[model samples]
Target chain A: MSLSARRIIPGLGLFVLMTVVAVWALWPTGGKVTINDRARDLAAELRCPDCEGLNVADSTTTSARSIRKDLLRRLKAGEDEAEIKNSYANRYGESILLNPDGGGLGILVWGLPVLLLVLGGVGITIAIMSRSRSTRLTPTESDREEVKKARGK
Target chain B: MKYSARWIALSVGAVVVGLGVVLAMQVGNDPRIDATKSQLVGQPAPELSLRALDGTAVDTNTLLGKAVIVNFWNSWCIPCRNELPALKEFANRYRDDPGVALVGIVRDDSTRAIKAYVKAEGIDWVIVTDPDSRAALDFATRGQPETFALDANGLITGAQIGPTTLRDLESLLGSAQGR
Candidate 1:
């Protein structure tokens, strides 16, 4: 390998390693994710049904406060997250869920964007690889003479 | 992209657009929009047991087999006062009906103010106070003058968000009776 490539390859490897370490450090550890954390996150995702432009966690409206308390209580009582969310949906309708689910019609809202991005990446990769592999003709002495004549003209 | 890949993407694009149109149509006709117009409608009437202004205990659950009209109001709300005359008349008319019960629950007002208003207005319809608005939140009430008419089976048959007219109350009661 060339001197530049050797230096670049090691540098790139180190950079990738550091990025992975940083991500691992910053990523939420499951051990630290308590019911309170889940409750807070759930509240953040619940739309304050009686308010404009505020989630249950952010809104101080009576309805918002009530739901927050209800959520925490239910969470503490051993009900799972999805069941609690479904109960809220049944009570307040699905609009109360600010974040759509990953499945069902909600897939259109979430999965479509991710799928499109992946497809776009694949398309770009294929295009670049195809262009690189395309045939290239080498210039003969006569071809070089013709190019020199064109430049002179 | 390869020809096959291009066609796959195009097909995905077409399907997405088709789903988009369907979703848009669904949103346009969504009954939830109207469902939230009065959130308590089509929901089971929440249970409430309270002490009336006259020191009498009133439990809504006991009256489950009868048509019940729950009126949420406050002393400070103008609409509540405006609708009181009709509510009084409605209550009077239903007093001997045996099949209907009208109960008024105070909201967002002090006990003193409500007592004053209830006494001064001669408002005699089983007036009760909802502390901390617990019952109100359960009923999904936005504000004062919200009314819910519930059927014998505990389902809320109809709801009104604003001031109740005699006609509106009558209509709601009729809906509760499956008329």
Candidate 2:
């Protein structure tokens, strides 16, 4: 094959491999279990105070540890998940939860990421198309002459 | 021009790979359980105001003249529940000592639950409630069953996180008494 094509092929392969690996490595495992089934279900919906990105069960923060203990206690006491979470929300406020109740600013935080991703994809597509159009050109006589000379050599 | 573009892409890929490796390392290093050793020793005791179970307000100011054992706990915490009996015994043993006072700070728990737990466990210390959890925030407490021994000057002489043994309690009390 041509030298330029050979060089480009390896780079493209590396790029694709890196993208796949990045997505795989960073995907959330959600190692959720049913220790206190009711509490686990509730905790799955609650955000961890120390590590806000994860649910309570998935977090290892001291606060999360305490919160999980409370959840289990409530569960064992025959309190349902909804009742327990509601009690916690009353005490600590709704921001303690991972999933915000529908409506208001909570919905906005949830929606913003998807909106940005769509906008970014559209912007990239337009930029790529515009760039390709601007850079494209018909081959000149000098280019053809060079190719012919090179082929002959 | 083509080769340069390829080189740029490859460099970017390398950087992304390096970043991923660093993040993975950090995640791997994350501690699974809370460390039992105290991080608050040598630091000044955090200011706190909590209402005793008897409905009297207790603050750091109240602890000024005496060395105090400030135990952060909650009725909902299992480890705290497990450690309460030992704490109760220790407080009882030191009850008559004017130089040493044992105080319990109920963290982020309901007053009703705390009262019930205290009653059931026969905990006789000055049990207090931090409904706002201001004390927890100030102490940077990650969970329940953390104990801090403060000198007469209100400086933290020693601290212990998680469940406390009778031996740990005695050593802390002994050190505070000695100071």
Candidate 3:
């Protein structure tokens, strides 16, 4: 009917659509550890010795597959994630873990993302403030009087 | 000249559209396991020297001239244990076949336990023990019950993780022979 109503209707529809999509994307797939999920998780943790910088989960190498199988077995046995990881660490050293543990140099890995987010927010705020200051009109009394005279005329 | 809000919105929309297109392309181009060629198909088999239960050595290099199937397994592994009967039978069936060799690599398990399991199962194939598991790492073995099919030239032709059927083994052997 009205131009504003038409614009509002589309914006509302878009908001609903976006909300639904986000929920669907973030919806829990039930258990945290299905057979495949555990396999994938293990794969992500275990480094593929054959493939540089790629975890077993991401690597298509034969070694990775075997590592995945091992991970699956460990998962099936009701072994906790920490124990499974420890097992790998025992055999292959700490480098086997894709993400380092949350201590020592590993702490930096986890902390950096948070630090970046905070810095980004601060940078954006500063940028907005700087831009507004540069573009803002500072009206003198003479300019205001001229504006008042123009309005009167 | 300064851009309008409309231009900024358009740029953001363009970026979102570009990201969506890239994601779609990636999903579309994702290869099925069968469609993807195995990288290990032609690579030299990883060298390993592990001792058999009888205190004898089973070396990959020594088996270079023969078509060998190196099966990594352990008694503690359920899948490995589950697949033992089928593997034993397969090994038996192919035992007389001079072109085929089945060697089992025991990973992260004690020699005594492996020997007991092999004896209980009556597994007649050559079983090797990787107590230190250095051989396992060398073979890039992730877990037990993984098999690598090696050609006569000691090049790995196929690798199967988890329990595989006899049919799977035959197909792998067929592929190795270029049949």
- Quote the positional error of residue B95 for candidate 3 in Å: 2.5
Instruction: Report the error of model 2 at residue B138, Å.
Output: 2.2
TM-score for chain A as predicted in candidate 3 = 0.60
TM-score for each of the candidates: 0.80, 0.51, 0.55
The lDDT per prediction is 0.81, 0.72, 0.71
Model 1 C-alpha lDDT per residue in residues B68-106, reported as the tens digit of each score: 998998888888989988998898899998889898888
Best by TM-score: 1
Candidate 2 ranges beyond 4 A from true positions:
A1-153, B20-28, B31-39, B174-179
* CAPRI category for model 1: acceptable
Assess the local accuracy of residue B64 in candidate 1 as a C-alpha lDDT between 0 and 100: 83
Candidate 1, after superposition: displacement of residue A21 in Å? 10
Error of 2 at B75 (Å): 3.0
Q: Which ranges in model 3 have alpha carbons more than 4 Å from their true place?
A: A1-153, B1-6, B28-38
Q: Residue A65 in candidate 1 has what lDDT?
A: 77
Candidate 2, B1-179: lDDT as tens digits: 35544554565566557656655766744333223345557667878777898988898898987878888888888898788778878887888988889998887778888888888878888988776466764565656778888888787778787888778888777666663
Model 1 misplacement above 4 A: A1-26, A29-31, A102-104, A147-153, B1-16, B30-34, B37-44, B96-99, B152-155, B177-179
lDDT (10s digit) by residue, model 2, range A31-92? 76555766777878876754537888887655666677777877878877778777655434
Candidate 2, RMSD to the unseen true structure: 13.2
Give the clashing residue pairs of candidate 1, or none: none
Candidate 1, TM-score of its B chain: 0.79
